[model samples]
Target: MRAVSLVPSLTEAIARSAPGAVAGATDWCTHPPDLDVVRVGGTKNPDTGRILSLAPDLVIANEEENRAPDLEALREAGAEVLVTEVRDVPQAFRELDRVLDACGVPSHPRWLDEAEDVWSSLPPPATRRTAVVPVWRRPWMVLGRDTFAGDVLARLGVGHVYATHPDRYPRIPLEELRAAAPDVVVLPDEPYRFTADDGPEAFRGLPCALVSGRHLTWYGPSLAEAPRVLGRALRAARP
Candidate 1:
């Protein structure tokens, strides 16, 4: 069966379910690295025409990634869409199970068990330090409480300094970031593309870590490696 995954998280899930069966993926889809999947624009502005042309039997979407109007259009076009909302780790695992069930693929319980084992093996997070994860540019939005990144940070033994903010990705003033004095500012590679070279000038004076956004924030089987890489970065960035 052919499928199109608009969300990055679901893209990974779809890939894990049936590696080469995913005929289309969003521009943000990077996991499973080099599968010959079709690029159908992005999660926000999916090329509906191009996707329809693929004649997919199933379409995977997410509340965070797929736009409302676009999703409506797809529904009107008679496509069977499976929309998933993954706010935390439990939801993420459930979504993976859903994908495998929908695709009629056997669930990889052993693999998932191993992934959970890895997560459980990690040490408790460093309670003293706080970290901010920037996921956008220009206005400079950061991951707040109630996001996948926040949960991942908690698992890695780090604290979300911006968790008190109401929004998941609120744009904070430079002065606030400076005043907050986070022990480590993690600049993720995608969704915002911040690198070490483009350090926050106000906080460049402080310690920082240039981290792989996927490993630190992404939820899926990839989460298996998160604690190790994130723990290393957090420890090394300590003053």
Candidate 2:
């Protein structure tokens, strides 16, 4: 079964599980580094014509990562599109099973089991830390209420300052974020690519944890490593 994936995590999941089943993927689908698939474009603005040209039996997409118009266009063009909505770890696991099964994967992938094991084995955080997680800079968008990343952090004892906000990804001024005075400033390296030299300066006196965005945000094989990778980073953060 030939598949084209618009979501990066789904692309990696499908590619790793079913091998040659994935015939195309978005340009941002970077995992499985040696993936040899046709580049369909980016998540928000995928090339509909290019995707249709691939002649895939299934197209995998995410509710958050993909645009509705693009998915509709694909369906209009006679492609079977499977859209996934993963708002938390358990949802991610369920969606993984759904997508892989739809793609005709013979058995459960080892990584999926490992991811579940990793999260389930973790003990509750001894001390909860209030954190301001910045997903982008410039205009400063943060992880707000009902975000998958916020839920992931909450499971690890890190709570977002804006978790009660209405927007999923709210853009607020940097000064406003600092005024919240979080226990730690968590910075992920995607969407904004915040590095030690870049993001820390914005939260001078606050403890800053530079984290892997893939581990924190992407739901795939990275889930198995997220607990360890994010835990170490969060532990090392000091004011």
TM-score of each: 0.92, 0.98
Tens-place lDDT digits, model 1, residues 106-200: 75755566777786676665465678777776777888868877887776656768887888889987677767877788777777777655755
Clashes of each: 2, 0
After the best TM-score superposition of candidate 2, give how far the Cα of residue 182 lies from its true spot, in angstroms.
Answer: 0.7
lDDT of 2 at 51: 88
* Candidate 1 TM-score versus the reference: 0.92
Worst 10 residues of 2 by lDDT: 7-16
Best by lDDT: 2
lDDT of each: 0.77, 0.92
